[model samples]
Target chain A: MSVFITAFRAFGSQVNIWLDTATPAADGAPVLRQVPGWLADIEAALSRFRPDSELSRLNRRPREWADASETMLSSLDAALRAARITGGRVTPLVLRALVAAGYDRSFEEVARAGEAGDHATPVPASRWEAIQLDRAAGRVWLPDAIDLGGTAKGWAAQQIAQRLAAHGPALVDLGGDIVAQGKPWTVHVFDPFQPETPFAVVALHDRAIATSGTDYRRWGADRHHIIDPHTGAPARTDVVSATVIHPDAVLAEALAKAVVLQGSIAGLDWLAQHERAAGLVFDRIGRVLATENFQAYLTQTQTHTQKGA
Target chain B: MKMTSTKRFAVRTALVTSTTLATVIGAQALASIDEAARAQPIPAPTIAPADPVLQPTTATGQPVSAAVPNVVILRHAGEVSAPAINVEPQAPARPSASVVSGSAAPILPPNPVQIAPPAPVVQQVAAQPAPVTRSSR
Candidate 1:
């Protein structure tokens, strides 16, 4: 089947939508056109970088129930689930920590500035249970500020893919968080160090995949976006990157970051506990490790090539 | 006041007979009262059905068929439905067996070649770009 692909920018990353159909004009064009608007709506509600965003307004007032939009409520709900599934390893209440680590502005600004300004001491994330959500009332109460970060992106990807799937088979990629539905799509797992070489290529069908790493978005030594909740600082670990595949994009994103924080050995062990979830971790020494079932998703040609090489 | 033994025995028997008769009559009266109470219908609370009160009607005055309150709509696997009121939002369904289970046969591509940077180099027939970690660049 011919694929109709569209690319745009949102959530501070390039967004790509792929529909498996030959007739773009008849089948996929209209749906593709709506993606940017949908993503913009989500970003307006969830982006922490925007001072006028709903998230910023909620963050300004803590310890009280504030009115929220459906986007805000649903995204926060998804974030809380991610925290629960990861045992608080992945949390939305890391805004203070992120700000302290000099990520107060957008990554573009931080990158262009070349140095993070002096900031306050990092405050450790509060318990995820402390944030209260009343979906029926369309309200949320935060114990402290939160940065949805990759969680929101993953959620947006999943939402878009679900919408597009009604027209045809679809794949939505918000940066690295991806969701594929309706058919098997081959996805490559790239080497964090090399970036150009793919260590493995696997087929994903009706599933989602995400990669989390410290190799990018660094402004200073030991400064990265993936914060360790325990230390309230950038994660100090031997694993440079981790990629996880699961049925849900939100969970995949959370699990990928959790793997990076826990490091390779313990992370792989943790990933095994989750049924039908597989992961690959690349350590600082260039060693590659994958969960036992990860190989099952590998394309046969890639498997053979690996064996021959 | 000494009496003959036969006289005393007759008096005692008479007293015992009266007392037995009175006890039997009292128990029978109590049983009848209890049966009467059981025969009465219990009064139920006077609550009216909520549909007529809360449900809105169409322009034609026909009552709209609203979703039954407290009734959850169950959907088939992978089917998306409107969120039911009062139901906790559930995580997306687990992937189907075709996704999680190992592929039975290898899907061989026609030929593979390297693309360029930003996108993964390897291209197999119709394969899409592999998602990389998010970077500012």
Candidate 2:
């Protein structure tokens, strides 16, 4: 197994990179650099931290049509499509809620800010649908400032995996959002109370898995970083964690948020009926739950699995 | 005395036929599944929803979902059979209630007390598999 792990902080969160392949490369420095460059683009397109970034700029110039890159436009397009698919289950309004809840900075910064974190409060769930994108013209027009946090980082990791397609079998994990070109890779789902305890171990054979958990990203015990569009606050659910797996990283990433929003009981049932994505949900009781397909996917011998159309 | 002879003959004939059929089917279809389950095999990480087009699955009555073990769900066929897995199709569904340990409150529309499916959680094995040592010729 050719394995590599790299770490850095981008998208305002510490990132861990792991890759596995059929043949090991002599050195992996060049392979690793691609990740940072990828992060930089995602930040430019999605980061709310930089006032000049796409999201920030859109928040400020909510009316003007700004020229957008194909990536930015496409990402926004996908998010809209996902929103439609999930029935407004997830919305970009979460960005406003995140900032208002003292998450103006990266997660690490929020964790460090303590009481001072509550300084610059804003309105909740700033409604992402109001912020529209023009795919044909590669431009974006916003009606108000909304947080794209619900989808951006996870989407970025997926985009990176797509660009790095030439690198053979690899796995890129942006925080908990992951996309693997292949497996021999072991990913442990974190335990909220004692994160040291891994709730599950996934063996991926060229697939993507993204997890959304309030564990490390919590404000208090009840408050988490994952905002629910419905309530415009952190998602409140019985699910300790939800991990989504599919060949499409974007789909897996988006579904992770939906699962988290749905909570364990409802989310688990939802997964049971919806087989397009394989899922795992952990309850506070420390029980494991997965959809039928997700269970079956785990049974196939490692190496290859078919996904999407 | 007449009843005793008939009972004896019936028992002998039934045993011979059932054993012959048992050998022909080799433990009986679907029988080994429950038997192999005694050890509680390591739970699979991903779950597949019942796809009418791709996998064969029984109608799932529950709203929230959990992964079912090894039972292949075929959507189009509306049938489930043993298969290698990975290549199978899945029905898209939502996660369960109260999944994580010390997690946020339940997110379901109605906080119902229901059993979450098993495919999501990866359980520890009761016994570890044996190691293989290589031999050089």
Best by TM-score: 1
| List of chain A TM-scores, every candidate | 0.95, 0.84
The candidate 2 chain A region of ten consecutive residues with least summed lDDT is: A300-309
lDDT of 2 by residue, B22-71 (tens): 88687666578777787586878675445432222232422333233422
Candidate 1 on B1-137: residue-level lDDT in tens?
88899999999999999999999999999999999999999999763343322232222334332122211111111221122122222222121111111112211111111122253121112544444333212
Which tens-of-lDDT digit does each residue in A220-276 have in candidate 2?
546667777666666777665677787776667677778878876577566556566
Instruction: In model 1, state the lDDT of residue A159.
Output: 86
Worst 10 residues of 1 chain B by lDDT: B95-104
Query: Any residue pairs clashing in model 1, and if so which?
Result: none
Per-residue error for A308 in candidate 2, Å, reads 45
DockQ for each numbered candidate: 0.04, 0.03
lDDT of 1 by residue, A1-309 (tens): 557677766776667677877453455666677788888888888999899999999999999999999989889999999999999999998989998999988776665566775667777789889999999999999999999995887898988887887788888888878898999887666544434345456688999999888766666667888999987998888766788899999999999999988987788788888997888776665455666566567563221111112
lDDT of each: 0.70, 0.56
Off by over 4 Å in 1: A22-25, A300-309, B1-137
